[model samples]
Target: MADKSLSVYKYMCKYVVGTENHIKTIRLMNTFTDNLSSNNIKVTITSGSFGEGLQMVGSDLDIMLVDTTIDVHDEIKSIVFNPTQTNFALMTEDIKAGFAMLRFISSPNPAIRKICEKFKGSNYLSNALFKKSFLSELCPVLHGPCISDKSGHLDFAHCLHSKYWVTSASQWTMRSNNSWPNESTKQMIIKYGVLFVPIGSKGSNNEDLEWRMSFSVGEKFLIYTFSHTQLLVMHS
Candidate 1:
């Protein structure tokens, strides 16, 4: 019985669970594809289940386009003026957790300014306007934070890249947890920072101006650390 169970486990690991080398190869190929498809102003990242090196049957393709030209800062003082990049300060006060309002600070680009609306004498980036600009006849469906095709096979999330971590999720890095995700992993996640998806807090008055914070990059890293057994359990 023990021998049979061991053989079953080995079979599962090789076929269902996938070997370590197989997973690594998939990840490397995805990375190469992303690099080839990305540009200086925008970075294309393969996200969701496939990005984590797990490709299930009938899973849709998740793509994240991180706009590098825009910068999101936690505070106005922390923002260093860059002639080429547009800047926005994160407004988390009175907002729900995992969401923030982006107040337009400065922008060299007119196209960015065109999407912003002035509220109470301050220019604010409008989530509605931002998402609207991406809309057309081809991509009409809005799936939460992502824009999807008519078939829904592909999901593209246009995100603003931010170097600084949001204040609301800052506690996660310092939280007392001994078993999983060591200090090194935490530091690496922090260094990767965060991305702001063009979405809002539900039922909030400032929803139209709010953008939900995304930790997909960190999440991908964490998922990569999972053992074959753990991945098998999750897959199951």
Candidate 2:
């Protein structure tokens, strides 16, 4: 069975692993990263799956953006990932009715702290709308599709069909006690880099505070080093 399975893998060996495709993928990766850097986002971009030899034929090109802006004020060491802040507009007239109804209490989620839950929802909504319009303008020019793929960041049209391409932009520091980055974590950073992505989970509104952190970077290294056979098993 294993032998036959390996035989079926022949096609993958042809299309997925090769010098030409690898060069093309790397070139595109560099292009995308360079463009992103032009926006003043000081991040060291790393291709997660390709160079690692874990890329599948129809998989979206995975990219990790490590922010190098913030540093750990440990009064000791220093390190970091790319956490960017966008200027969000103030809350709307509708969300203000909350604090009283308990539906819109004063919280950071709504982005309005201290006094009330000013346009928190609106702020989030605005960010999405802004990105949509921005991608439409920038992505196509680079031949990089920013199409939505629920599983990842963007989508790609492989020889077979569509593939969800996920790109994580994060803030990973080499030195700090931010619960995620620290001295011990620096080695891992050197291996895969850092990312400050959404740090939330699936649950209730109160429990779902979608905080951002650095985790996938570590996993990238693990999968990157996994044996080719193991990687093939994952695809299986």
Each model's backbone clash number: 0, 17
**Model 1 agreement with the true structure over 71-189: per-residue lDDT tens digits:** 88886774467878898888888878888888888888888888998877888999888987887787888888888999999899999977877778878877766847877887888
Best by TM-score: 1
Worst 10 residues of 2 by lDDT: 157-166
TM-score of 1: 0.90
lDDT of 1: 0.84
Model 2 lDDT per residue over 1-236, tens place: 99987776765556555344454566476667646654443443444455354445666655443323222111111223223422111121222111001122122232323212224352132112212333443243212212334545443211000011112222333235665434554465454432333222334242122223344446655554555555555655
- Candidate 2 error regions (>4 Å): 1-6, 15-40, 44-48, 71-136, 139-186, 189-194, 206-209
Which number leads on lDDT? Answer: 1
Error of 2 at 76 (Å): 11
What local distance difference test score does each model get? 0.84, 0.35
Which ten residues in a row are the worst by lDDT in model 1? 12-21
* lDDT for residue 1 in candidate 2, whole number 0-100: 100
